[model samples]
Target chain A: MSAALEALQQRLGYRFQQASLLARALTHRSHGADHNERLEFLGDAVLNLTISRLLYDRFSGSDEGDLTRVRAHLVREESLHRVALALRLPEVLKLSEGEARGGGAQRPSILADATEALLGAVYLDGGDAAAHALVKQLFGELIDTTTIDNWRKDAKTELQELLQGKRLPVPSYRIVATHGQAHAQTFDVEAAVPALQLSSMGSGRSRRAAEQEAARQLLDKLRAPPAR
Target chain B: MSAALEALQQRLGYRFQQASLLARALTHRSHGADHNERLEFLGDAVLNLTISRLLYDRFSGSDEGDLTRVRAHLVREESLHRVALALRLPEVLKLSEGEARGGGAQRPSILADATEALLGAVYLDGGDAAAHALVKQLFGELIDTTTIDNWRKDAKTELQELLQGKRLPVPSYRIVATHGQAHAQTFDVEAAVPALQLSSMGSGRSRRAAEQEAARQLLDKLRAPPAR
Candidate 1:
């Protein structure tokens, strides 16, 4: 094995009995037909399950919705890319000449995929314990460091969570209008809770964003005193 | 413990070291603030990982996309609900007086979440081996029985995969029109592959169905000889 690969394994803290698995893990589909796609698939599930387990254990006071959101944030492509960069994945990734020239190694999706493939490789080589340990080592600090308040919750999440805490039925949102040019359209959304007779509207560049804005306003109304 | 609980333990093939864990897993959020939501959150991950590892090892010849599709089919709400029913989940579930009167025990989401909570309880009480064994025992028949041909792939999936196999660009779909009453509108969708200079339109009662039909027609077009 090359010294670089050995160093990569050292960083992972999980040495592979079969070095070929590590090599395959770093290979991109752009490189050849035989590449990391299968490993990436396996690794994606492993990474999600491992992270979900971690979040579930650490946040006893948090509900399932909170746990779900936190897990989604932790395992999303951006976070995986961060972990890949931390492990210097871009240095050893194998790519086709075309992709290499196009900067595929630096791409977020590829880096994140390779990260999952690495986990899958470890699991295949050393079983769950080794893979679990690697996941913990790579992600432990992030898990410990992430405060729920550290990130912005989308307005829909904020609205639903506020209602859930109060054991009230969740508010609903609907797209009320779409306007402007086809290229520069805007979405107008209305969020309402029928039981509370509360409603609000907001508009934005996308349907989802508009819904969030509307939800944010509706949440504020929920917080305010009732009007005569 | 009640005789019914003991019967459940017997069926599970693993007695909980902490009986209270089992009891908590059986409790619904409607029952009280302290409920199975947290355990259900943890168990959902454990179940997904266990099933993923199983599928990964068993299906060596299958591609990642195929593996993903199969896993999704196995883990969807209907599948989980079936598993829960087979385990006699309804007999032992605890709900609030209101929910109980409304037959909440038979609800798919409740049953599925409770099933997951039981997994969490087992994992917590006896650790990974116990959990793995439980999952394997519960799902062994399902793992053995399911074949790729048993479930129908959606038109969009079939089209995308056909293109993927041929190294062609994926098609894009857009809603072209909506007609009829608001209560029962028909959607017209167009699927296009600009790279292939091909396009098709289909109409259906729903947007998704219309898109699928359009994709089906596009696939048919791709299969036909050159029109020029």
Candidate 2:
């Protein structure tokens, strides 16, 4: 365990000033009475603060919605679980005999928790500055490196938020038509603001997809200046 | 505009390789025909990924909820506005005449947007690596610098999300007691989970504040292990 912990420490880029903190971070609730739950709590806050600041500073022009979606994507359960695996966090995680046999280490929720617990350990061992430095080094590379121009666009999230804020009824989407072969299908979607009797049509590979496209078009129309 | 931009550049610790991108980043919609909206979108995604990685690496033991809250607080409207002001962003902002007089330059939304746009500009001016380095340098100092351990306690938001997600009746709060004088009053609150028939109590300085405390207590009860 110590050897694996040492390797994890090397990967984490921070030497724990207090070895006990590191140990606690690795201890899961299933392991015994003592566990990483508290550390998970603290580390969650520390991690969130660091990441929030990074996003805030990096995306100055983005509205709250875009910022939120991107952040959600980055810190989601799946992504965090991937990072945990990349760190080989599961190898050193302490689990009960039952949990270990049940493959708790590979579970997304557990992995995410362990990842957070490690952050708490770093925060406790070295304090906020150390935690911040470590976090920046980890996240900066991925965020700064990736081109995020091509992620899926969700017009529903945008429209729901927009209409809710405006005290307007939420828009609804319906599949108006479908065409072409199954392998090369095309869908015609209609998004309607029922009260306004304004329905816009959009085409895509699936009804849901087409509806989203229609919503985007409708949003543009709604936001456009009124004609003279 | 150049002087102000130069000053901002110096403060953020990056020299834009493509000055045009930087210029576009700073161009607010109100200021001119070309605005920072597009740059804002890209920057938003970049910021989230960067920050997510940072937090993951820094706080190895944190959980999703904890990280989410901390990030939300750090990147919230108010904090970004302060950072924007620190960059003296308002001084060089292009705004429509109406917006200028309405003080849109200093508005929290505008200031936060400009900050993200600046990040996009940095990303474009420099590569992702450069942008990451710049964002990390700028925001690294702000991580977990708050006075209150705000990360541990966002009961109100949590309660709202929980109710919304579970499709349970929204928890309702009522003031159970009040203590102390007007200047230093403390209210005791009871939060009732109607469906669960579970009620918890908490105390705070104001009604809303007390309600949040009660909500926290309620959440704890909900999370408690069931009796065998």
For TM-score, the strongest prediction is 1
Q: After superposition, how far is residue B197 of candidate 1 from its true place, in Å?
A: 12
Tens-place lDDT digits, model 2, residues B1-228: 377778877988887767777777777776664678766665654565456546555655565556656667666668778878888888877767767888888888988888877876776567556767866775677763532245765787788788788889888888988999999999999999889889999999999889988998898777653322
Sorted into a CAPRI-style docking class, model 2 comes out as incorrect
- Across A1-228, the per-residue lDDT of candidate 1 in tens digits comes to 998898998888777899889999999877765689899988887788788778877887777876888888899999999999999999999988878888999999999999999999888898777888989999999999987654557778888988888888988888989999999999999999987788999999999889888987987677442231
Q: Which ten contiguous residues of candidate 2 chain A have the minimum total lDDT? A: A145-154
Question: For candidate 2, what is the DockQ?
Answer: 0.07
Tell me model 1's lDDT, rounded to 2 decimals: 0.86
Stretches of candidate 1 off by over 4 Å are A151-157, A160-228, B151-157, B160-228
Best-fitting candidate, scored by lDDT: 1
RMSD of each: 13.5, 9.4
Q: How many pairs of residues in model 2 come into backbone collision?
A: 25
Weakest 10 consecutive residues, lDDT, candidate 1 chain A? A219-228
Q: For residues B23-51, write the lDDT of model 1, one tens digit per residue.
A: 99999887876689889888988888888
lDDT of each: 0.86, 0.74
